[model samples]
Target: MITIQNLDKAFAKQKVLSDVTIKIADGEKVLLLGHNGAGKTTLIRCLLGEYRPDHGTVTVAGHSLAHERVAALRKIAFVPQLPPPIRFTLNELFEYAAKIGHCDIDKIRKNSIYFGLNTDAHDHKAFYKLSGGMKQKTLISIAFSRDADIFIFDEPTANLDTMGRDRFRERISADAMKEKTIIFIGHRLEELSSVVTRIIELDLGKVIRDEQA
Candidate 1:
């Protein structure tokens, strides 16, 4: 389970997150909805132990993010909206992930195929040189191919095509969500309704609505 209690964050003079409190149980697929600057990214960063909450505690599977950051982060697999400017080749990227966590490079390759990404054709290509869709595909494949208890996706479908989106939906079906906790940050409510068990809306810096899907 994941717990956020009295969460508050600020950047310089801007208060980005308020005293937000929310609990997400295991196997729950939550869709975090918000416009730009609504504090969605801030909240996600807190959950991943990437941001220090000014006045709150965040616990993932009973591990406090403040005190046990590495432990808490080890259980999480995250994909950001914008892929980082990494210059590693596809093979090198997979090699790096293998050292970080239980990364299934084989599964990543299979997933690439599922998304029609044809990884074999660009195995030696620099990651940053790939097209937007290809980069998203690689990131998604790598994230999902890891051994993680929590999965976080920030606008994962941004650069996907019709076939890629459909394949993505298929990969995240119920069978794939059996035991993992998913926090999907998305702007639109499209085909994700079937995978998301809850919807959380944020306005400004506070949670405005939270409901069962």
Candidate 2:
């Protein structure tokens, strides 16, 4: 389980998150919804150990983020808001991520097909040449390849067409059904309703609502 107690954060002179507290049980699919700059991304960064909370505690699977950053990070995977703007091919990107993430290459190769990444695209095409949706798909593939217990996704369907979005959600839903905890941060509410079990809304710097979908 993941738990946050009295979490607080600030940037420059502005407070971004204040006394935020939440508990996410195992296998839960939680959606973080809000307008731009509602502190959703900041919270995710703190959870990922990329940023430090000014005060409070964050624990994931019984490990404290403040105390066990490396250990905590090993159990979580983050798909950033923007896919990396790199010059490497899709395959090369995955290969590098897998090596750094310490993921299983064979499993990643198998899952790459589900992302609609063909062997041809994987072999020689540079990431910049792929469509935006394809680049997002490749990024997601690499994130899931890590086999982390918690998966954090930021605006996962930003650039996908109708069919691509549906296909991507299908794959993610399948994974969630297998009891993976997914924390999705996005502004697209309609797209998330079908997949999210709970919705947590943030306004300014506070969690204003928490409801079951």
Candidate 3:
């Protein structure tokens, strides 16, 4: 389970999130909905332990993020909207991920193939040198390779082709993911409705709507 209690965060006097409290149980597939600047990214950053809440606590799987950062983070697998600019080659990146987490290289390769990206064809290429679509696919594949308790996707299909997008939705709905807690940040509700069990909308740094799908 993941819990955010009375979360408050600000940047340079501008509040990005305020009194935001949410609890996500295991096996919940949630669609986090919001327009740009609605604090969705801020909340996600907090959950990832990239930002500390100024007035609240974040707990993942009974571990407090403030007190046990690494332990809390180890339970999550994340794919951000924009891929990071990493200079490492695919093979090197995979090696590093495996060192830090329970990363399955073969599963990563299979996932890359599922996304129409051939890992072998680009194993020696630097991540920063790949096309936008390729980078997104690689990030997704790596995230999926980890056996994590929670999966967070932020606009994960932005750079994917139409067929790739369809495949992604299918993968999210696959039985293998049925027991994991998945949070997807997306604007296309129609495309995600079939997979998401709940919808949580944010507006002006607050949750305006939250309901079952």
Ordered by TM-score, highest first, the candidates read: 3, 1, 2
Q: Give all candidates' CA lDDT scores.
A: 0.89, 0.83, 0.89
Cα deviation of 199, candidate 2, in Å: 0.6
Task: Order candidates by lDDT, high to low.
Answer: 3, 1, 2
Q: Estimate the TM-score of every prediction.
A: 0.96, 0.89, 0.96
- In candidate 1 the C-alpha lDDT for residue 133 amounts to 92
lDDT of 3 by residue, 59-143 (tens): 9998998899888998799998888899999889878877776777778778889888877889999999999988988888888
lDDT of candidate 2 at residue 50, scale 0 to 100: 79
Two-way TM-score contest, 1 vs 2, winner: 1
Candidate 2, 1-213: lDDT as tens digits: 999889999998899999999999998889999889999989988887778999999988888998988887887888888776799876787788889899987767776677676756456888878887878877777777886888898988897777667776887768444588889988877886777899999999799999988
- Model 2, poorest ten-residue lDDT window? 114-123
Per-residue lDDT of 73 in model 3: 90
